[model samples]
Target: MPSASRIAILGAGALGQQMAQHLRQQGRRVAGFFDDTCPSATTAEGRVLGPLAAVATEFAAGRFDELLLGIGYRHMARRQQVFDELRADGIPFGQFIHPSAFVDASVQLGPGVFISPGCVLDLNVTLAANVLLYTGCLVAHDTFIGAHSLLAPGVRLAGQVAVGERCFLGIGTTVIDSLALGADVRTGGGSVVTRNLPEPGTYVGVPARRLR
Candidate 1:
């Protein structure tokens, strides 16, 4: 277990509240929320925290050291905007991994990442900032997942694979060993990537190929 830290969540959606509940249950202090629109006092799962905007002053005061972005959208442009704004404002973000996820000691995860339940990260897997690993995903040894990527449920990356920035691996997709997925790529559900994908496009089907 890590030391207790003061944290704030940016969104009040399902993912945001789930993270808050998980962290609170782990004995970490959740300071407040910073939603664009005000969130209800009780979240979907009935986790009660105060008003969402209470952290505005805290953000300006430099009191909170960590922040989490809980929006579930896969739009890289919007995500990058938020990241750039936060970076300009100088709030350091921290990665959130569920206690049940199995991560090897050799793995290095970047800030503002979310690793959900039943996930396994093998040795030396490097995940860049703001990446999301959905439930039951498996990333094998020596894989590099770039910044702002999202691995949907049941996605698997074999050893030595390299995924570029802002990529999305759909549910049940599998990437074979030593393959390189280019930047801004998207793999459809149940696709099998056997060759290197060098261009950015939506790929689907076995031995994945770009559709457009």
Candidate 2:
């Protein structure tokens, strides 16, 4: 495993704090956070080093070896924008997997992936780049989560499930086996997806009917 001596986070919200804590617990140094909202605020974990505007200079000066995108699903486009910009500048992205997460040996994880504590990834699970799996989520065998998708805390996916890119699976959402969701799909919290969602839209309720 490659160790990052210093890492800069792109957000300072709940998820960002959790990521920082996870990194710290692994003995990796958290350089600081970069957020537009609270550029000068200090959190229990650490202080805000600077705004997002300073990322280029910081990266150039070798302040941090890797960058972690801590932004949430609501800002998917912004995340992608920043990711692309930094990637073009030759900055590398980092993956953070909590110590308590159970990822199978056969599971494949891409760069910038974040697997929260208590998450279980079964055999043959493939999570593409920048995929986010929140706490207590369960991904069964042979499941594929597309790049930039976010699985909220407690979301459960049965075997052979395929979630598309930029999709957001709400907290406590449950998807049945062998279902395929299209790109940009959004499911409400506690939704029970029983069938294939081939359209890009918001889905809610027990049967997970598309709402747009």
Candidate 3:
């Protein structure tokens, strides 16, 4: 969130802690963490406010201004489910785009989006809700990344590329221009995608072929 809103992260794991660190760098106040496993505990990020179940009640009481999901790429389904449910429950979600990233004015980002350091989102790029781009990724013009997709560090996408929901682009993966990847698609580290991936599957290699 760009405002002075006190953001609360859901889950205080490694991702949560790192997210807290970046948020702090941007001069944002962290209200605390809402973790089901570590209520009543305090961390380097902030105190564990309560379990996930208590988020609604606490929100109603004005405990925190907005929510950020620190759920990682490994749990894409769970991540999408939690975000949708919380949003449906009227919990406001926040976007955390790191100060070091360069996002063009024409870019559109959905809620709960986390953009890490040194990333570049060029003209007209659209990132759907709950999409996370790790450090130093690059997205060219007119690209659309679907909801809940995660791009690992240094992943690169050319212009007009369309990535489907729940997709994971591994570290250093590269997709050329005008390619459309189906839902649940995954690419291994260093994979180079030259064409469209219409089927949901794990792909790896220089010319990205689906793994059997």
| Most accurate candidate by TM-score | 3
- What CA RMSD would you report for each candidate? 2.9, 1.7, 1.4
Tens digit per residue, CA lDDT, model 3, 8-108: 99989999999999998888989999887898799987899999999999999998999999888788888889999999999999998888899999999
Q: What are the TM-scores, per candidate, against the unseen true structure? A: 0.86, 0.93, 0.96
With candidate 2 superimposed using the best TM-score fit, by how many Å does residue 164's alpha carbon deviate from the native? 0.8
Cα displacement (Å) at residue 60, model 2: 1.5
After superposition, which runs of candidate 3 have C-alpha atoms over 4 Å from their true positions? none
The global C-alpha lDDT for each of the candidates, from Candidate 1 onward, is 0.82, 0.90, 0.94
- Could you tell me the C-alpha RMSD of candidate 3 in Å? 1.4
lDDT for 7 in candidate 3 is 94
Global lDDT of model 3: 0.94
State which candidate has the highest lDDT: 3
Off by over 4 Å in 1: 39-42, 45-56
Q: Model 1: per-residue lDDT, tens digit, 1-212?
A: 66477788777777778777887776777766666566546555343333434444566776566887776645676676686677666778877788889999999989898898889999999999899898899999999999888898999999999999889899999999999999889989999999999899999999898996
lDDT value, residue 38 of candidate 1: 60
Better of 2 and 3 by TM-score: 3
